[model samples]
Target: MSWQIWFVYGLVALAVLLFFSGRVRLDLTAALVIIALAVSGILTPAEAVSGFGNPLVMLIAGLFIVSEGLARTGVASAVGVKIAALGGRSERRLILLLMPVVAVLSAVMSSTGVVALFVPVVLTLAREAGLPPARLLMPLAIAALIGGMLTLIGTPPNLVVNRALIDAGRDGFAFFDFTLIGGCILLLAIGFLLTLGMRLLPQRTSAPSDDRHRRLHEFAEHYGIGDQLRSLRIQAESALVGKTVGEAAMRREHGLTVIALQRGRWLSSLNPVLVNTRLQADDVLIVVGRPETIATQTTDLRLSDQGFPHGLQRRYRESFGAAETLVVPGSPLVGKTLAQANLRARQRINVLAMRRADKPLEIDFQDTQLQSGDLLLVAGSWSDLERLTGPRTDMVLLQMPAELADRTWHANQAPWAVLITLLMLFAMATQVTSNLVAVMLAAFFMVVTRCVEMNEAYRSMNWQSLVLIAGMLPLADALAKTGGADQIVNGLSALFAGHGVYVILVGLFLLTSLLSQFISNTATTVLIAPIALNLALGLGYSPQAFMMTVAIAASTAFATPVASPVNILVLAPGQYRFSDFVKVGVPLQMLALAVTVLLVPLVFPLTRT
Candidate 1:
């Protein structure tokens, strides 16, 4: 072997160690690998940096925009609500309903975000529907892992393989390429959990339910300001449409407290309504004041009284529909109070009560500084209330009243969202346009048709994901350029000489899946894909089956919380032990392996001999 091969080998090993160490970010580690190769003269500077400009990167980014459009129009959450409704408050049935629904959602959007949004809903179901959090969460996590299998943009690994095929001078996988195999696998997964999987899950204890009818309690209990918490929408010709919260001054003249400021229905996001944000037609105001005062100003203010939740109208000792939000550890609002953090002025939610360590603090909550894990019971419109769901969110919503379910958003722009997606799929499947061009066009139409906002399109992208894939792409090029990929493939192929192609498939699946349980699935795919492709060609088999094996194995990341972000999101709330994941995940991984080995050959034949 040449010195260059030895050097590449050492660098690949070091990069793997660093990825598992968790000390450095995966993208940065990938960047280091690219720099080392470029500096060592194994790859030219242009080759080292070529990955960032790849069309696959653009395709992924454009898909993120299309997904944001789906989310903005309430299409995604509406799907969740519909499927959840099918559960009918039954514990076992809800698990059956939630698992497939979540899987389907994850097939389109980020699985991590889908799990984040549903965590609170799952917790609520456990408490009210009398289910164990563990029983529901384990399936939720596993279903999300399976969801990534169903579409072209379902997971990053699928795209990595397609890029590998394209780089090898073959056509990339079509948009619906994975649908047949992946959809079959998804049905099997759903069946597995519905039957044997739940028995393996821990029957952990459930948490207590919260007060759902206490929203107006802030106004009635504190100041006797109003008997009902009311919402009013400004009409197109309303005088309040162009005014800011401060200018409206409902508190001074109408004895009304501005609780939340909301945006238009066609727009995206459940963010808090800000005080300084100018009101638009259809902009809803969540306010607390005397019913008569609000009614008197409705006509004069040129507003439409949107009415409060059903429970709020007849309720008193309790508050209006309330949700508990947790202050995440790294949140910038960690040390600030309601007033200092400007929660009201910015997100426009009022803090009714604060609790730490399960004990309610009797001090003035508005003046009190919030620490990590502090839970605040907040009141606002259901649409404005569902905003805080992910690790990036400042306040993680824990639970919301069931009354809001009836008032939740729907799939209004669903047809447009579906049309754009289908157009992209047709372009890819038919090869009429490049994958990048197809997705970008779909993304453009999504925004022009008001399916997604401009800002949200940008936010939907996971830059680290894009950078991680871009940076790691050069490693494969370096491997092939420096003869490292050939060396590795030859050594492994010789070790299994005289063995059938099925043996190689099993080895690749096991190696990739095992590594994926510790490092990320995408990184695992990037590192192993080239070798799998090389191995197939040497054996006179087409790269088709081998590449498919690598992509599917890369997604078998069920062994640990650290395996994927979706697992970690559920860990604390599920109160699962590391052993808990392994207890169930190990068996599931074995099931996937059997399924892949049996299915891959049937789907993509290796009969090149």
Candidate 2:
């Protein structure tokens, strides 16, 4: 290989290595590759930055904005609730109902977001049904994967391939051009999964159950305690000393309901709802009613507030302060304890509580390793609080005063915004307007109307995937420009020409599918589309047919966690083991392969070599 060829080969190798390593982020890795390509003269500065401008790249970014709007407006959540209701507290019913809903949503919006939004809801429903969450969550993940193959915009891979074809002077694929085959493959996968494949899933009965009641108790202990109750004492000489809580009329006189009664080493329940409960002397009544009412009842009982220093009493009020902040990934505070982060000393914000990834914090504050998604609670004035949190991506201000850190956020949008995005997507899909202009106009309107704020629009774009697509484009061009593609195509043509186009289609699909499992989807699409086009050119077959096969196979990464980021994303939340993907994905992989082989030739005629 020449130095240029070797350079291109090294770049591809380096990109794949860094992506799978998971130590460096995918976006950063893409940026490094772009910089390397520019410095090496493999691409001009314009070409290096061109990925950010690619039509397919913009399509991905624009769809993200739309999906974020839908997510904020609670449309997705509403759909999730309906599916859960329809599933009616049964695991098998849930799989049947929710899997299709999630798959369809993912086909239009985002596979990762669809799974992220629904996985928790499914888990909650499963817990309510007393089913192992493992059984439901893995199926949801696979469904998202299957759904992404259903449209041109369903996933990044298909869009990347579509753009590659357009760039090569072929008409771009319509939104549903490949949907017939992809949808059939999806149904087949789901059918097999529900009937026979589910039996292959390993049963897991050992996961921790949710303890919502206990969590609620901890919150009440922290926030609802009144100041007057801090000083209420039952002394040896007091009348309350020998009286049982019920006999003393503490519930009636003090207007306090005993939630938990502690007597030395044991706790007694006094709730009238608990049958056959009892009260004992020296037992402390953990009351829930009110503090002012208790103070009035104890006032005639002669309680003394002396003995403890007034300064010592003041310390309780001074120990903690509050501030509102958002959680950003890779923040120093993420996955750290309150004491470890020195949250009080360095930031002067008390660790009151946290909201994380659309869920309330259930982990113990002191013990919880703050992951990337956690929103923090800090104490400070508005100005100082903003000053502290403004630079931190991990912290966003919680605007609701009455709201606890546990509430799921519901972000509503202006209806006009959704209408405008729909109009743009429709025009682009129908070819009434080119996608490049459509996305640009849509992004502009969103900014003007404040649908997606300027900063958010900038932040929301997937720059890494954009860069990966652009960076590899020039390399693919370099290959074709240097006769590298012709060399490979000629070899492939000689080897497979006598075998026929079906064999050639299968060969290209397997190669693209295998490469996509390990590399960036866009990169795989860019790398393989040109080769597929070249092979078709050399063998007198339809390049469109070959290109469509690459597109389908590129999006169909079913058998491994590393096959797609969409698969890896749910791993932690679903608590999925690595083997989970293999168990469910193997059958789907075969199904997609069968569909591609059968459908591509019929759609795009293949001639004899």
Candidate 3:
């Protein structure tokens, strides 16, 4: 082999190491690979950057917006509520119903989004059903992963493989081409999860019920802040009468946190607490501090302590709400102090308190640097709280007060969102337009119809995934350009020289599935697709069977918590250890392999037509 092929292989090895190390971001690693390829003169600048303009990237972005439309307009939440009602406290029935529902949803939307939508619902169901969350969450994650195999656009790996076919001057896969095989695998997984998989899961203690939907007073008591929450009226002679919250320095000087303000006679109308909010002579301040400190401040500041009113909880619930949010890994907010995040200004919400690993932080936590898995108690208007439920990188909504269940922000547009999604599917399935055109139109309609706002459409795009895909495409191009792909395919062929094609298929599936257990499956698919295609052509067989095998193998990221983002999303909530995934996931991975080896040749035909 030439030095260029050796150099490309070295870069791939380093890239895989970086992915496994978890020290550098996946997208950054891809970007560095792109730079190395371009600067190494293995490929021209145009070839290196060609991936940015790939239709697959645009289609993925458009799908994200469409999925957000369903979420923002309450379509997905409605499905979750219906599932909860149908399951009704039976562990067996819940697993039976939940896995299929999640799988169906994952067929259309991103699997990660589908899991995020269902996590809170599944947690609530577990609590109500008297079952450990461990019993249900693993099924949910597995179903989601299998569901991606259900449609051509179901996962990025499918698209990567399809793009390889199209770029090779062959007809690309149709919308439902993957459905037959994917459907079979999903059924097999559902059965495994319902029986043996259920036994494999640990019956750990359930996640805390306090994280479920609760009333205001319940939330206060759970956080151990009930005694700290007090109401005081500002007297005319009070030094804080005309001062802003920032100017009064209540937290700095008095060690009190003003959480809400009531200005008018009707106590129900609570104004959002903000730094620029001014205090009036008769304003009632709902504050959080030690009881003794509050009493002392009442006298020193010339204010009257009007112990919390009988209807205070009701009034607070009507005007403001509280929720528990988990700071997810890789959040930009990680390592920033609460004061630096400025949630009150940016998100229109205030951080009331924080809990890390089930232990509450100190009172002076404003300057505390945040970390992943920190559960925060935040208070804000119902509208702002509703925004937290949307897709965000900084935090995941663990639970909201029950009052939000009846609150409808975009419920009216749900039918339109569903209609638009169905129409987009119809267009793609019927071949009326290209898949890319159909998806873009659906995204445009989602915005024009007010199902999702313009700004939200932009925010819904997962830029990191998109960049990673674009950046890694050039590496695949360089591999094929530098003859690296041919070398790998030849080695595999020689190793399996006397073995039948079925053995070769099983070998490729295992190799792809193993690589997927650590790195992004999409990147794994990008690097392996060209090699699979060339190997099949070299063996005088059709490429479709090999390409489909590669795609299915890439989605079998079931054997580890770090395998997929969906698995990591459930790791903490389910209280699962590394061995738990191996116990449950390895069997499922073998099941998928068996199904793929038996079905791929039948579905796509290994023999040249």
Candidate 4:
């Protein structure tokens, strides 16, 4: 091997370590790879930097915008709501229905995004369906992984393989090219889970768990804050729909405190709440009052229960009512007056009383300026109260009284959201243009169709993932340009010499699958696909066979919680440990492997040439 190949190998090794170490981010590590390759003369400056302009990068960016459109329009959430409604308290039937819905959504949208939409819905559904959350959450995450297999744009790895074909001077795969193999695998997965996977799911644990982390009413009891915490939606027909907190006189007329108003479809700190912030239709108010008073006010005000279907009467008694939380040094709520901070409107907690530096503020608590050491008596769901003490926010939950329930806003556009998603899918499947052009067009339609706004489209793009992919592409280029890919291919050929092509196929599958367990799947694919491509070419077999193996393997991030973001998202909510994944995912991984090894050759044909 030449000096350039040796240098590229060393550089690639260093980059892989940096990726595994988690000290530096994956995107930054990718940029470092680009710098090392260019400085070592492994590639020209333009060659090292060429990945930014790759068509795959544009396709990924455009796809992010398209996904943002579907989310912003509420299409995915709408599907979740419908499916959850059908869950009907039967675990078997719920899994049967829920898994397929999540998979189909993941097939069209980002798998990670699908997981995000489903987690809360799963939490709510688990409560209604009388199942432990852990049982439902793991399946939801797994189904999302399977969903990515069903379409070309289903996941980034699928796109990587198709791009490998195009870069190798072959026709890129059309959309739905993955459907036959991926679909069959998905069906088998569903069946496998229904049969064997049912017994593998976890039951609720009893390790003195935090009650605040449990179901809504349980969380309320854990915090001693019961019916005082309630959610009300300002409907169009309600008298308070267009009124501001101060104008509505909730405190004077009804003895109620408006904690937080979940106003607008999107919110940020830049959009601050004030006393004059008017309530709009569908706005959810986290308010505090006694059961009878709140009920009387809601009846007269004509407010909807804000999607909180839990029976307050059932959990009413046995209350410490509300508790005081101390504000330690450096909370966001510090320094602002009760009127200025608008804790009710801003953080969605009612500040009933305050004691500054151990001295009670018996009078004028509302207008008094907050200090660093203020102890605040607040009321709301345990969940909202817990947020104040979170590492990201200010104020500790006092570890006692805090709980939360699922909340909703702005669901009226759900039909439009679904319609826009279908249109986007149609464009991609038909190849209305190149995948990149179609995505960009669908994204534009999402904006012009009012499914999403310009700013939201901009915000929804996962720039980090995009940069990570773009940065890693240059490393792939360096390998091929420096003869490094050929060397790697030669090594694999020597190991598998005189063996049937299926040997190399399974080898690549295991290699890619295992690497994805630890590293980013897309990164694994970018590095391995080029090698697999060259290896197939060297052995005089169809590269498509090998490329397909790599693609399926890359999506096999089922062995660890860290394998994929989809897994991590469910870890806390599902109360899962690292070993839980191995226990549940290993068998599923084997199923995917058995299916892939047997079916890929039949579909792509190792001897097609």
The candidate scoring highest on TM-score is: 4
Off by over 4 Å in 4: 62-99, 105-145, 148-225, 229-288, 292-420, 442-461, 490-497, 500-505, 508-591, 598-609
Residue-wise lDDT of candidate 3 within 206-289, one digit each (tens)?
445544568666677777786788889999999998899989978778888887898875523467788899889999988888
Least well predicted 10-residue stretch by lDDT in candidate 1: 311-320
RMSD to true structure for each model, in Å: 11.5, 15.2, 13.6, 9.5
Identify the candidate with maximal lDDT: 3
Q: What's the distance in Å from true for residue 559, model 1? A: 7.6
lDDT of each: 0.70, 0.59, 0.80, 0.68
Residue 241's C-alpha lDDT in candidate 3?
Answer: 87
Residue 110 displacement (Å), model 2: 9.8
lDDT digits (tens) for residues 94-126 of candidate 2: 888877887887787657556644654564456
Candidate 2: C-alpha RMSD after superposition: 15.2
Question: What stretches of model 2 exceed 4 Å from their correct place?
Answer: 87-95, 102-180, 191-414, 440-483, 498-502, 515-551, 557-587, 598-609
* Per-candidate TM-score against the hidden true structure: 0.52, 0.52, 0.54, 0.56
Clashing pairs in 1: 213-319, 214-318, 214-319, 214-320, 215-319, 215-320, 216-320, 272-347
